[model samples]
Target: MDTNAFRHTLTAFRAPRPGAAPSNTVHRSLAQRQRAAVSQPWLIGASLAGLMIAAPALAQGEAALPTISVSGSQYDADDVRPEGVTTATKTYMAPKDIPQTIDTLEVNKYKSYGINDLATMLDGVPGVNTNYDMRGEGVLIRGFSADSGDIYRDGIRESGQVRRSTANVERIEILKGPGSVLYGRGGGGGIINLVSKQARFDAKSSVTLRGGSWDNYGGTIDINKVVNPHVAVRLTADREQAHSFRSGIRNKNEMISPSILVDTRTGLRWAGQYTYDNVWRVPDRGPVYGELPASVSTHQGFAHPDDYVQDRLRVLRSDLSYDFNPAWSLRWLASKREASQDFDHVFGGTYCNTAGRTATGAACNYRGQLRQNYAWQATNNKTTTHTLDLTGRVDVAGMRHELLMGLEHSSEERQPQVYGTVPFGATINPHNPVWPAKPAQRPAATQNNLHEATSRALYVQDLIHLAPQWKLLVGARYDSYDFDTLNRLTNARRAASGDSVSPRAGLVWQPTAQHSIYTSYSKSYSPYGGRGMLGVSGAQDDEPRYSRQMEAGVKSDWLAGALSTQLAVYDLEHYNIRYQPDAVNFPNDWAVRGKERSRGVELSAAGRLAAAWYVRGGAGVMSAKVVEDRSAPANVGKYLINTALRNGNIFVRYAPQGHWYAELGVTHTSARWINAANTQRLPGYTRWDALVGWRTAPWTVTLALSNLLDKEYWRSTSMPGAPRSVLLSANYQF
Candidate 1:
């Protein structure tokens, strides 16, 4: 049936009062009985008799309860039915029905926490860690790092290679453990999918302005409008800037995103989105070991040498879903993403010479032993993807079940250009560090081309119900990937391809209405790394390494699902792998023979504790030791990653029914080594942030203080400690 016709029928069917007697009913209308027979051919015997008996009530403005709500498929946390899981899984398996951990973060959570970025918000999730580099942001789950190919948006594959902002997200789902059975790539560690906000049936708009520390200021405007009953569009734009804090570094950012959704009268639902981001910054060059002047104290502030960087990114995606029937549906998605970055670094800007050769006190010279150097770098790439999925429900033996089948394909084209420049300078005396400058010399630029030979996958899963309280899930997937690269300078091209079959099995048992237990095993595969991370040789798919995981866990929900918790134990194996030496030491070199492994356990807990008070937190402790490192010392035994040992977080929230709210959060990170040597430790530390907010209709004011204690901590694997800073912001929604 068509959408409008279906809506009208449903509306009429649910409009009448219960037990109302029929008014226009005849003993038996031939047309009505014929239509009912055609619509519900499976109804028979007693069920057919019952429907016939109730036909008068239906025709008389007396109907049964309506299953559809104004909120669509979304439901309030407190209203979820017991033992009924979300359709995110074909069978609506309760959390317990899925052995692995799958955490869902709703839009309401982001509103309450005021979280606008994935890194900051996900920090509260258990087993999730983030590494903030000068270049961008990266995350690690369960001690394993995030891969570029593992990201998704609304069930569609996303490069997620851009590290700009997460303001456009409606919610985020972090599925723990390998998910190759469902999602083909980068499932070794797990995957985090960002679901973008959509234009709802109702129209809503908001605009916010904020200002904070370090000269940081920004504003955002988001609007959603329903042009007609079946069409809607949303637009968002924001800009932010910050300057000079611990060092004389400056940063600036701007973003614009727009999306349109079309709900047609036909059974088709579609949405298209486009995002543009640009960021520019001059990062601190940091200090060199033993380069200080005698009169200049370490505590004294100093400006960094020339360091500038600019990044631009663009993303476009279209998603579609068609409802063939109430119990069956299909979805198709397509997307394109691209990014470009430019960087320049200059050193020896009036360098000071004090004990330059030795770590000792000596006469300080402002000019001796000085030289100027410059370097330029750039990277550009683009990717396109397509996916088709079908979902349906079935019944066997007296129990109901769900099944999902799908196919995916993606192609990427990348061209990375490398360039460098050097300028001549007049000779200067040893007493003067500044030299006469000359025009900069332009160096040769080389462009390299890389192409992904389209990765494809087909998979199907079945959720079997043996009883009302028990379920079994069985699934398998066939994945294929091909890749090729051309060296622009050398004109060298190479190609490779491979495929794999993965299987998954699990069982869930619900001993009580609010609790469930399950165990499962799944497999995952990826071509070592995607085209971007892997060099020409590593891009070969001939022997794509694979990873396997075995997990079993229990989940509990109480207080009508307002409060939830999960406990899981897992063992992960990464095989047919290759390990490269430290990037800092080896730089661009590749490792021909790579083999390594990591195995460990993870734990986490989250959700609300009470109405006015909410608590969401998690802890991850693991023993992730590298089994082998061909370049490491023989007696080293294992390369134990200290950073993978432990990570924890906790948050307390208080919001009354009035117009005020407050929240405080504490985060802890364990010390990790910079490399396998284990001599240098990252120095574990704890930090806290707090906020107090007020809201009255369209006006919302907030006082936020991050790093309240101004603690000195470091997150850079290269740098030991990072100085603390603060930001205070206020925003208004209209």
Candidate 2:
């Protein structure tokens, strides 16, 4: 993104309150220009056609270049080149030098396939899975669920687990394994950073219309303009509606995201962004529990006609940066996020008795349905975070060192209201049923609570260039965390505080410019806060749960960085896992498990294989088990829930010098346990997909077919995979 080419929308920002930064001016000429890479060139898809036309400028008027028609960007070497990333560390580090494995999902690929939802956008990442359950959509990295705190936007934690929309997203970065040394309390799982597209100096705009099977359709508008050399603005909005393969389920989603960039006379570079999103959908419940009869089609749905889930969110983020010299700089980031959601669900009928048994203790001729219930819940969440990072370079005792010191403060308040379900007044056989009568009256509120938490942290890191071939990276962080929970239902309150220290160390040996070998150990922590911070449960008031990992890997670049590859093996353990201490006597008392362990290997490759061929995706194999839990001695050797043993995804694309291209993709996930008892499983599945597109100077059109075989399978323990589907997308630029 630092390149001369305007191929990327690169002015990303992280900041504190809109006006919290000092107004003092600093010289910018000598400071390293700070920019986050929000684009991946190889994924530009049909937009590659436009890049080829602009290649002359990228060439610097050098030798005669190969002619590329209005088709692809394979020959536009400079614009399509892969660049260093900033996620693994706060500073930019080349792909071959990162000690931790970070995987990226670029923008172009999803747009090409008409993907708009977060779960769909995350389809092929290795060691990561997306799950849609009654609780809401969630992401699991290496079998550990990423709580709301672990999902960040431009490195800032989001407000809550609201529905996710890609309308404002530019790209995604996943830092695998333990990373608590940076962010404070969170899931032990990896981090998911959603980078939003920022205002760009180059003027470009587009309008796209998309339509797909199940009556899915949407339109988007993107406008970027250079108001002047010192300022720029960008706006992107989308409106989409869709029907689902699950009978009777439907959706309507909307998003408006805008960003502004400013270069003040004081040498301060500032960027601000805002997003407002609203979503509504009737969720699918799949099938009744323990009743997956062959006669039931996957498309069957059992949701109540009136049941629905809706979420709305507003977020404001600002960044102010200044460069003191080529070797030193500082960036201040602030964000405020608010989310509100309401959910209502009705259960599908469950079998009540054996086919020939009756409630009266007599033999019966037919199976009947159990009485079902409808639940109502709502959440209101607000979060604010500020971070200041000072980065500098210096020579310490003849060894060059890259130093980063930072501090962060964040606060959140979550109010959750729960209304326990009311039983339906009627019942019908689940296997062959008709709509049952709705409950005549709802029940009293079961619980109402407000939870507030605040955290302060200081962290420091130094990357020492010990020699030309070796680099050592070391960092540590300390946190002061406190929380207050109010039981609104009973007008009672509880307060607690805890703290932890996390550390990381990594050594990179770049034996050659193209290849590097790295090994590292890192530790992180997760407080007692609930996954979405509604409250804390399932654990005692102890120090934050901690996780550690030891990893070794090799990274390499090919064809002058047009392609990148990595292979890594790791062993990770999470300690203080929650367990029941005395469920038989004290049903609410929860204790801790001694430990749980997971070991895995992963291989990934991205970028060009040759002029016309490109590849991206990876394969991961892991085995996760419960090491010890004295309270539950029977579970000591069982496999962890939802941790698949093997998963693989691969995508290959071919684009000629002409005006047409094609791609093929495949994904595989091995069966894994889904319950604590390890008695149920989410069946493994293999799926195939394909895409074709054609482009010209100002127009591009693509057709994508997913779930080509329409295989019947479950994506997670609770949801069924979508059957075969098709999408047709087109774009025009002005």
Candidate 3:
């Protein structure tokens, strides 16, 4: 195939209109930009060095082009439309065909903007909010909290406490609404699925180094090799060490991932992957009571300089596929994941009351507004998960159907240990804190409790093409969860068991290949054994709580598939929420008589605007409220905590056929309540980011600035957004 013809086909859908500038002028301008780029001495030198390093490979006939295509359609290595998503139905389908709202962050988008972590990468997704927690980064999808257990890697559950690295990520898929039909025992908020880089038969290699403000520095290496026609291998690794903007806080992390694929001559394929990660950091809790005082410094943290938190993770995965015929295929996947975390730090507790001073209030100052630090609080947790899936596709009654059936089992054990606290002679004022010297002979922590949980699930889903312009999706899942808790201090043991079934249905109508309107309804459940925020246990007789959602959306492709846009409206309700009836007298007495609801409209657009312009952005308007609260009448009809009423983000980039490009972006979030009673609030804020880069074939350099206006704002309750910072990055491909 002629290469120019192939390029034209990709752009033909968005061809310039009549009466516009001649296409020849555009070609000439591109040529002029290339010539101008060549005049830059640094760019020329970098290009020459890259060519010299690749000369030997070219001489040996090992140098290959950046992308390869066969027939008239391009393959994975070259597709750039960003119209496909797999997490929604566990099958590759256009977003327009799916009946639910799903958002994706492609590797190119994040790489261009120099986003390095999962939290930052999710900035522009509609209805998604990010925050910080003592354990790890926290997220709220729709309106409910999604913890580490709610995150997945390659469709397998992974711990959320570990910091996520983007070095080995191919893309990030955000599945909105209820997902229990695929994943088991998760909140209704939704899930974040991280797709890892796969081994390519066409080999490629690259290395990148980055440095930024706060003494941040890191390096990543990605290498892929095709050993033979049947075997391919790929490896990715990265190391980062940095000091935080907060005083006495530092971070260090390392990750390595390797994958292999085997294709037999008999229409069978197999792949295997493994990843190891180790991370260490000093934990920081933002200002007291989620507020910054005039006398307090944003850069100061109450945690000791030596306090630290660490996480270690290991994962193994395998996949196999066989084609039985032109219309039939079978695929199976299995994975095992293990994770552990250890933390020791001082965190802000209750405000000291000097007037009511007693032995417990000895640390209080005369002001009675000081924050007493909880010292030597330590915890260790470990979890293991295993999963298996089998999927197939066939044609029945002149209709094509894709089916996925899976099984999952997970076991988790957590042991929390806290040492005796050492009282400080001087009270640490919230507005002004005085550093305290390290104490000698720190006490050893004894096991406080052992909590263990085991879960098993079976699920199946089918996508059926009912007609040329209509599609139907149906699915269900059954889960069995069991938990056991043993209190060492009280010598008490308790166990609980529960089961639940979740269901989903959707219908889609396509008036044209570029436009689709769809509606869907789904249900999700969370057993007591699942991550509980209220310290409730599964030992009770109460069954698992459930959530239901109804959503309708329209998806359209514009500019000949160069751009994709989506508009969706949804109503979600969560029931059987646990609440304390009387916190002052019966703090531990809880009842499941609470209900929450979220109604929202979301709009999103992504992909290319023109040959030289690229854009990705979204906006959301949501109203989350406590619908019913029999246990806490004061919170009835109140807005949900941390659920913003409006949020949006947009990024625009201009990159012609030259060695230089520039980008500008903005993110905005509306004010939100910080408590169930809606008494405290977090003000709204907007942040800006900019990027400039120059590239020549295998070498590229970039400068990225975050918080361009240096806005001082809170991202969550007390978590302040990072101040203005700059990052410089360089990449070389071989």
Candidate 4:
């Protein structure tokens, strides 16, 4: 035979056939191949890192490991879904594995969408809305809402209590539905968890400078270091200054976040974090309109009406954990936070025709000049929380089980004082006043010096497997809260305490590898002391309320876990609620204990379906009604839709190595209505975002532009939505 033919025949004979190799040999060979494939991407990533290193280090900084994990929930690469776990508790886990509805936006997604603030980033989550106040920000999930400080950071409660920037966040996890079982009192419609960044094996550094419309300018620098093998530290800071497009509006903000994490090879870990925020703003209070629509324009003198407020906040946290074995671990955490704000505002009649006057005249002008200002009105608050969590996997009665048990205690104190002053200038003529002659006035002053609250809770849960395709979950929790408020201005005090034993039961069945069906029953509670205002006698009090939620859903995962779809139906009822006249302020003497119910169906999908194609969508249909309201009729139910589509290019080189990367995506959200009246409808909106990024080695850049169309519609609450904006960010590794 010829030499070529002889070699071909030998190769054919050496080719292995099915079932020809031993099981151990096959396993070893597969492991070796996976190792080689995983190692190749770093080599290429190294070259990219080298190119980015050439960029000058513009300011003060340090260095760190090349790789960092921003997905949160302490998960490894192969199990990226840990952040998805949800069970009406403070515990963190992957979203997909959790029995409840949970979603996440990691650092990559945040950077790609130009969402550096928690308020802006959370607006995209389904059934979640934003409320922008003169002093701070708020969020509503599943129709339940809270102010800034309700968010959690790494299972430890911090005092973000009001609107605070998300400058140090590594990832954001949003849990939909009620979650009061383990988080003490405040999880009416679920909770939002902000995961902080930690030092990794690959040391790295980064600096980003961004500028946009309305004279917006800002910068951020992040540094990380892996000191030796067991200790790592990271630091990040940001500063932003901007002018609003609305006439006479401006804002400035600065934030710094630093964290240190220590872990010993012997399985003991400790971590500490600190955050500081300073913000100032001058914005429009509210525009007035009569029966008829009006057209007005102003960018000049009196048109430059101004109102402003200043705020500052500080937060600190520490955590420690130890592992007894691969299946068992214990953790403890401590935290403290402080925040304050000051306000000054002036509203003047612009250069426009009065309601009854045909011309702009001093007397005919309907401009009832009300110059009210609050001076140095401070709201000081502090909270210290202690948490202990136990998580482990064990075998019970010839079956596998997952267990979570924890204890938490929190004490919070709030001191608020409101003082108002008249106009800054002295008044001239009572009839015809000069522009600069308006005298400042001192209005009334009131203070709440002793607004204190405390909560203690203990919760335990178990996930038991009964068969290959079935699992049952049982959980219970006990919570007790004490609330007290004393008004210095009135010398009045009211206090209350209540406790409850909440239980949950659920069943999950996975008949096939592609499908999971589950049904869960959960209980939640609420208190009626939100606004902090007592009427008539000027007393403070807290009233107790309760709720129960029953939910059933089926989830499907396709394309080898890349695509996920879920359909769920839920019925929730709230009873013993002290219905106040309104949400803003209530008379301390009046209490309306009533009942309300909300039932709905929800559908959602996420992840990639085909190569380079990704989709995320959600739709909700529900009826929320007040069953026992003497002052009002049953309100109509509103419909909502939240859907987005993402199509982009993929980095093929990373796939075989068990890595994933995307370059750009087109994301869009459907319109949603706020009230059942439907007369007040917010237009649907869309935007574009991109992600061509890497976390390790040299440097990586990600750029995002929100509201590409500059649509000035409302996304949540009573605030106008954001306009077209751009964010350019970059990170480097050393």
Best candidate (score: lDDT):
2
Top-TM-score structure, candidate number: 2
Model 3, 176-262: lDDT tens digits are: 898888777778988787767656554357788888899988888877677788766777788988887777777888988776666
**lDDT tens digits by residue: candidate 4, 391-495:** 777777888777778877777777766654433443222122233522255345644456776777888888677776677878887988777778787677778
For residues 286-334, what per-residue lDDT tens digits would candidate 1 score against the true structure? 3332333444332322222345778787766555567676667676555
Clashing pairs in 1: 578-594, 713-722
User: Pairs clashing in candidate 2?
Assistant: 14-333, 15-332, 15-333, 15-334, 16-333, 16-334
Q: TM-scores, in order shown?
A: 0.77, 0.87, 0.84, 0.75
lDDT of 4 at 55: 24
TM-score of 1: 0.77
Task: Summarize candidate 2's per-residue lDDT along 1-734 as a digit string, tens digits.
Answer: 00111133332321111112211111112243253321111011122224322331221000000000011123341122234445667665554657898887765676666677776677667887776655545677776777555776666666564777777676677888887777766666688777665565553677888999999999888787777777677787889999988887898999887776666535567666667889998977644434544555667677778778898988766566777767777876656678888887776434346555543355544455545567777888887777788878888888878888898877788888878656555665555556655556556668788888787888998988788778888999899888777878788776668888989999988766667789999998887663423542322254467888999999876776567788999998889876557767874466776888888999998778888797878999988888897877788878888778888788788877876878889998888887777887778899998888877657777888888887878887547888889998887776
Task: For each candidate in turn, give its C-alpha RMSD to the true structure in angstroms.
Answer: 11.8, 9.3, 10.2, 11.4
- Extract clashing residue pairs from model 3: 148-160
The CA lDDT at 334 in model 3 is: 44
TM-score comparison, 2 vs 4, better candidate: 2
Model 3 — TM-score against the truth?
0.84
